[model samples]
Target: MNATTDLLRVDAVKKSYGPIQVLHGVSMSVARGEVFAIIGPNGAGKTTMFKVMTGEVASNGGTIHFDGRDVTRMPAYERVRQGFGRTFQVARVFRDFTVLDNVIVAVEARRRHTGEAVGSWRNCAPSADIRDEAMSLLADVKLDALADGAARFLSHGDKKRLEFVIALAGRPSILMLDEPTAGMSPSDRSDIAKLVSRTRKERGITVVMTEHDMDVVFGLADRIMVMNYGEVVSTGTVDEVRNDPKVREVYLGKEMVSA
Candidate 1:
């Protein structure tokens, strides 16, 4: 695809903490509306990579381009304003805030033209339009019934859904999710996978996620990027990656036993 169609591009990105290097010259790209998955074993730097992409953690080397702008040095809030949104592996919600209010906060954050002025607790006049949009998102995530309930009261599955709504409030061109299915029940995991699939098909939002659940990755991702240690060992479709001997050796801890 052309530059105009690329939503995110990471070129030769590297990161190190003191004497230990975590990401080793990684490079990848996400198209405008594709669901991409990054799968690897534990401590493979997947979350670190997400943090670097969102500017939460600075990369020691390489470039990150979002919507054709160089954002390697941009701060996290600035990146959020630039249509790069992310959800953490751990559910982060305002425990006391109403479900709707939590999403409204994100909406306000996105509405501000100047990222510096946006505050997590800032109160903005809830315009009819904003309310409608926020409510719509809540409904989309099946949280409309609990819109007025305290965020902490929601179940774990619902909390994950709320995070998705919060991320979407930014109208992001790229949505990065860190283990969206972690700590979820089997049915809840399936629900989330279906929600992600529907979101991708209906909203055309580019999805990039790091997940350990191979079932979730295989079910939702259009493409998979497999990393071993600090380096990407394979990038391909789900079946291709599953069939790659090197990927199996690193991720599954054994060579693929042929039928």
Candidate 2:
């Protein structure tokens, strides 16, 4: 792929927690509109790497660039302004808020970040336009029916869908998902996977994700990056990474990948 087509670039990113190093010279590039997956063992530093990429945590060293600009030191909010949308491993919706309100908040935040004069936010009710837009997002995730329902009352799969809707409200250029299908039944996992694939296709957004389910990973990812012990073991097309000797030794075994 052409270098210019790359939307996200991580170069030698390093992170540490106290004396324990978590990410060691990690580097990868995500092309625009590609579904990229990062996989490894439990302590492989995938989440830590995500934190550094999204500005949730500061890196001890190295640089991160997005859309042709350096964002290594950018704060989380500012990164959101630059079109980074993220959903956590655990769905982090506003439990007390209604499903509609949860998305309303996200749309409002996006407006604020972009300096779109949305009127006084103090005691402000969601405008008709925002409500329509928010509902549209929810509908995309098939959660519009639950618009007035409390988020806390939704099933775990529905909550994850709500979170995805919230992220979509930001109109992100790239979407990052951490274990999007975690802690769900196989059916729910399949639902989330389909939602992700459909959303990416419809929006033309780049996706960076980590998933433990190899079936979901192989089914959705255009490319895969394998990590081990805070380092990148391999990065390539799914077939290439799946066949990599190093990746086989450290992460996926022959049986695992073949199955």
Candidate 3:
């Protein structure tokens, strides 16, 4: 892909927690409107990488560029405003609020900046546009019927789906998800997978996700990046990464290699 077309670029990025290093000289780029998957075994620093990208966890070294601007030191909220959005491994929701309300809050945050009231839900002003957009986002995630329900009452899978909708509320150019299928049953996992694919297809949003499920990674990724010991071991189309000996030795292991 052309460097000019890349939406996000991470150059020799490194991160540490006190004396321990978590990411070592990791570098990669994600093009606009592409589905990019980062896969690894447990403790490969996938979540830490996402946090670094979002500026939730400060990196010890390296540069992060988003939409051609350097954002390595930008605050998390600032990153969100710049069209980068992410979902956690664990669903984060406003438990007491209705699903619609949760998304409305995010939409309001995305647009309101500071010192501005989100205003009454029934307000007829243009600010009410957030509510309309939030409701539309809920419908996109197949949660239109649950719009009035308390987020705490949603099923685990539905809550994850709701979180996806909330992420969309920001109108993000790039959506990063960490273990989106975690804790989901097989059927629910399939449902979320379909929802993700639909989001990419219908909205043309770029997707970057990390997953432990090989089937999910292989089935959904347009391209894959494999990381080990905080460094990217290899990255390529699914088949190329699958055939890489270094990836096999570090991640797939000998038994799978033999198979």
Model 3 residue runs over 4 Å out of place are 1-3, 113-129, 253-259
lDDT of 2 at 23: 95
For model 1, how does the per-residue alpha-carbon lDDT over 101-162 read when each residue is reduced to its tens digit? 99988887777764433434555567667778899999987799999999999998899899
lDDT per residue, candidate 2, 59-86, as tens digits?
9999999999999999988898899999
Which one is best on TM-score?
2
* Residue pairs in clash, model 2: none
Query: How well is each residue in 1-259 modelled by candidate 3, as lDDT tens digits?
Result: 3446899999999998989999999999998888899988888988899999988988899999998899999999899988987898899999999988899888888767644567776865436566678888888777989998999999999999999988988889999999999999999999988988988888889999998877788788988999988999999998888889999988976665455
TM-score (C-alpha, index-matched) for candidate 3: 0.91
What TM-scores do the predictions have? 0.92, 0.96, 0.91
Q: Give the CA lDDT, 0 to 100, for residue 98 in model 3.
A: 91
Q: After superposition, how far is residue 137 of candidate 1 from its true place, in Å?
A: 1.0
Q: Which should have the higher TM-score, number 1 or number 2?
A: 2
